[model samples]
Target: MLFDGDNDQKNKFIDHSMWNRLINDAKTPLTKGVHQFQVDLEEFLNIEKPNSKRGDLKPINVIKKHVSGEIAMDKLEELKAIVHGITSV
Candidate 1:
């Protein structure tokens, strides 16, 4: 099964028992804080509910639409800062 397949179709790619253990670990307090940063970042970028069918509407595409235009200068700087902050962490 391919990675793009539905969950059931991709089950063959994983060790279910080990996957279950990882899922359980994800619910623990230590892992909870780690995942929260991802949620916050997605919300900050307005891509928290990304739709595969509308890739062009995402931030990267939006930024690309006006990268060379004056209107995008401030936004581009803001985006650069956010990206750098994430990478630095």
Candidate 2:
């Protein structure tokens, strides 16, 4: 079925199964640290809970914060690594 059709219609193109594994494991933080990071990162960026805007500016904001020294470079690198790991799944 189309993903996020009930909330973020723009993301209706995504298949539900493609995201099911992540959502299913989200609450089990012991093995879902990446999911937890995603949740917290979205919260920190004032992002909405929908993936409709696939290219949201929140990540860019995080980068901007890093460049402006609001967030440390090491932490930014950690975020990047985590993001890469998650998306590569």
Candidate 3:
């Protein structure tokens, strides 16, 4: 099954697509001033801090959260939460 697939090139596109949507959404605001998005982003990164600390995972480990399936639901939610970190929401 494709689910079992592990093509690095294909996975890079998937990761970019996912993160770009979020990064674009959480990138800027209508007003020119400090924003909560930064703080929320920090919190979001902290969620994955454990995996980061290990230094064993790939640089694009967020993509793995997808391969992990629903087992990584909370991580997805954290991603959503981070995307909403922008004032646009």
Ranking by TM-score: 2, 1, 3
Q: List, residue by residue over 13-62, the lDDT tens digit for candidate 2.
A: 66544455546555444543343332356444343443546657656765
Best by TM-score: 2
Winner on lDDT between 1 and 3 is 1
User: Which one wins by TM-score: 2 or 3?
Assistant: 2
Q: All candidates: CA RMSD in angstroms?
A: 10.1, 9.0, 12.9
Task: Give model 3 RMSD, 1 decimal.
Answer: 12.9
Give per-residue CA lDDT, model 1, range 45-86, as digits (tens).
Answer: 443334768845555654545554523456557656655554
lDDT of every predicted structure (CA atoms): 0.42, 0.49, 0.41
Q: Identify the superior model by TM-score, candidate 1 or candidate 3.
A: 1
